[model samples]
Target: MNQPTKKVLSLFSGCGGMDLGFEGGFSVHKANLNPIANFGWIEGPTDSEQVLLKKNRFETVFANDINPDAQTAWTHFFKKSFGYSPTTFRLESVVDIVKRHKAGENILPKNVDVVTGGFPCQDFSLSGKRNGLNSHKDHTGKIIGDEDIPSIETRGQLYCWMKEVIEICQPKVFVAENVKGLVNLGDVKDIIQKDFSATSNDGYLVVSPQVLAAWKFGIPQNRERVIFIGFKRSALTPEALEALSMEDIPKEFDPYPKATHTKPVKKDVPEELSETKLSDILSDLPEPDGVTDLSHRHYSKAKFMGKHCQGQGEISLNGISPTIRAEHHGNIEFRRLNAHNGGKNIKELQAGKPQRRLSLRECARIQTFPDDFEFVIPATGKTRKRWDLSPSQGYKVIGNAVPPFLAYHIARNLEEKWNLFFK
Candidate 1:
């Protein structure tokens, strides 16, 4: 008998990277350039996204995000590129969605095989001033600090909605991803774990959180996120999560995919990691952006005033790319590659003219976004136009997304091993 595809309820699904990874029907854009150690090309050089002939193994029943821009970008990718419209993606705040669902006005499904999301993390991030839950300035107009996260208002409270969704949908499996800072941010981790385990139904058996680095998992960027997984307390069905025996739930979730590609950091260990470099992934592409006059970083008033941060540092072609950020387009983004000289680092040769910021395509590549996976935003989202971008929607969507390739590896592990939890 043919097995039914698993359905996922995705929340805070900005730009659908996790959704696309779980729905693994598309081919990656392979970079024609060579790899550092013959791992693989950055992305495939195809104009159109390749589709899997067989039906996808997993389906997204619902995807929600508060931002209209993200919805627009997602709609363009699916509707314009794939010729299939996904009403599965709805633009609604998770808080409102849960309230409406509880009130019997929402259309979300009552039962789902899995639930997943990278909840709003600005509250618990080490960066962004560690605002925690207090998003708004106080009556004194001072921003709240780490001590105030649990008691603050604003986007920080949205994470509790994740627990609420678990309460309502009562999925068999649930996974949540967040910034690494969540583990150290006061009592945020403990609070969230307790809330997540306290689902309205029978609650769940939560696993110890683990930090997964994107670079360790074939992604070029050095991005790290803490992952949380939970299984329902009691067996619900024969094919449901009950497939995993209660005696072995923790042991099943204990081990995860180890790093396949890594840089040689110590003398004892051989380089198992691919050590995918920025030049290897992005060198084949055409220039996406440039500033003729402001190309080179010079010793000047503006350079001094800009007070460039870590992301602004010039990246070497030989190393992993920096983490991609959402808001800082020109500031934190990487410098453009000089593909002509055997894909030389822009800083190495001191390119005669000037260095430019990475284009949207390059940023997408760093985030493991397939080249064919198009971005249609208010900024330069088209193929022909790359430079002179005042990106409002495009950058945020790309930066905020979980790399599809990274998510794919995680989903693939879940697909094969979820049964073993019972075995």
Candidate 2:
């Protein structure tokens, strides 16, 4: 009478964000902000929110990440929720996993139903050096990085490893997320998709990739990432399969998972009512305490770690945040009060400080991580080296995560549409 849970194997699963969405056992915190200038988190996910993620029908059987701090954060949340450690293996490289399988080892089970990952994006990031190898027909018409792909030195070739896993495990559906820059990075997108669709025995339908904005999918931030959602030809209905080419699939699945929220520019549009803002998410979060020590644990004291040099900067307390970045640490946006305490700015409030940095929990909330998801970064510590990071790694892991809330909609859409194949 009930369907069995579909198994998932995740790669590059930093902190289990994607896997958590697939498992679907947590609920996020929510609240209403009124009177405009509120900077408090009136609500956070309840301690028991994990009990509420059962509205979906999938489970993560295996997950892996290179960062141990990410593993710490990953294990910390699941252990707290499930009362046992999850299957997120650490210290294992995707290259090694693929090699082991090719060398006649069973790194992953052969019966995965769905596979998902947000592979490393640094090489393909337009903001970065864009050092990955690509066709010379790019905007600049020159291959910036001639480094051989499949070379472990650069992360660009890691997609090859991802493809290898998909080829061997042969899941019915596979979804990959990456920066928008990838689609336009000359031959990088073409090479990866061609490799993905090349498998004859268990090939994908190679649906046209769509770049999705997180805000459109209910996330408060204006993050945009390209999504590749492909259905196995044998797993779709006859009519859906009739239009299953790289070009045709987009027509059939047009507006795949239509936006539930929007931010219209016109002040009169009805959709404007649904636009989420930074105030919507963090207004109720506790404001940062004024502390100037960059070494301090809590984001109490904001730091201009590299505001001028790295292009990382601050965010106004009353506005939506820019893209939450991985390496910025506190270099990125920190909320500052407009006027308070006899009209003193955040700088004067904290003994001549300029602004206040957000705490780790607040950052997680910004990443749409449920309050109870539990980033392992300590509230205060002399040194967080035990977790393989300088305490600031919490922000890195949170920023690098796939935002489980967004992944939830993607996974839920697939489960509803493709579970018929599994059943």
Candidate 3:
């Protein structure tokens, strides 16, 4: 009998974007469907329950986070709601978790085929300090913003920890997702190359980096992320690699995905591909409210208005939505309507009213989350309503997540090779 399809173990599995992408497959349009079943996941931070619900993509065998609050949220949601009590590892860092597994302190599920993650990008981000690996001292020395090493403190060396996990797990295929800046970091690339070389100390080869845009794969967002794929030598034949390199590899595999959507303007095309406009992404959401306070009274008034008003546009009524951002809660740009024209003034445009920011639901939609997925907001003051998380946090999460559709394409392209050569 043929062996069961490869099992997956996801690391830094933020809301399971990479996991979902590999599981659902990718498409150029909404009509196309490709689904891969039989995968499991592990995510850090206990607070990922909302993220998991939003993606609603894969089964999780392991979930871990250093934050007690995040773990609490996960246990409450997954265990209490679905009776799926994921192995919860608290106190231990990701590296510690990997080490424990390696030393046989904890047992991994059977037949883990692929390991994936979008590791922390703070140190490698343009907005963050440019400290690469050498920042470890600063991180450990309790140096203000640099202390927390791989977890909350210094994220510079987080990739190193991820590499350790890959080394210890030794899965057949390992996939890493990170900000595009990672490829630009000379030291980061060097470290990856070195670790990859060591991982393949035998004869296996590692392919070059591939940067992909979500838009080209059918999602409406314009997010770009870099992917590093390492295949084990023992899992592949020379002929298979040759076949993969020549025949089936995607056309725009080097620096970006091919542009499936284009604009008439030349300035629009960067090294990354472009797709559906903001109008295309959010045309379906309702108009923003014109209030500006933290009071539930204000929010209630706005909600009442929204419910009664005809609203400008039709509800999206589709599965896809634009990527959500944390800034949506307070930013004028995020609140602005998608009209190609009209609305001369801020007031006319509904720019910064009280409830002007995108709701958590709207933010989730923008990030391409399914409608039924939920986020837990704490109830505050006289308003028993849970206070939605900061729009900035939403932005960070969505901006950093791998677009599932795009990931699906890469996985589909690689699936045959995974089955024939790796298996």
**TM values, all candidates:** 0.77, 0.80, 0.65
Candidate number achieving the greatest TM-score relative to the actual structure? 2
Model 1 worst lDDT run, 10 consecutive residues: 296-305
CA lDDT of each prediction against the hidden true structure: 0.65, 0.64, 0.48
Using lDDT, give the best candidate's number: 1
Give me the runs in candidate 3 sitting further than 4 Å from their true place: 1-3, 25-60, 63-84, 88-92, 136-154, 200-204, 243-274, 287-332, 337-355, 377-396
Q: Which regions of candidate 1 deviate over 4 angstroms?
A: 29-56, 80-86, 137-153, 236-255, 266-272, 289-311, 336-353, 377-390
> Where in model 2 is the C-alpha error above 4 Å?
31-54, 83-88, 134-154, 246-255, 271-273, 288-297, 300-302, 305-307, 337-354, 377-390, 419-423
**Candidate 3: Cα lDDT at 76:** 40
TM-score (C-alpha) between model 3 and the true structure = 0.65
1-423, model 2: which lDDT tens digit per residue? 886778888888888788787777676644211112212212333353222333467777777877877777877777787554555454577777777788988668768988887877876787877766532222212244545333432466666677777878878878888988888887878777777777566577766678888777656776789887656667666666655543545533442555666567777756444556666666555434553422233553444454355523555444456677786454555555334312223543465544556667666776777766655444346764454334477777878888787787777666666644332
Q: Per-residue lDDT for 206 in model 1?
A: 73
Q: Which candidate order results from sorting by TM-score in descending order?
A: 2, 1, 3
For residue 33, model 2's alpha carbon misses the true position, in angstroms, by 14
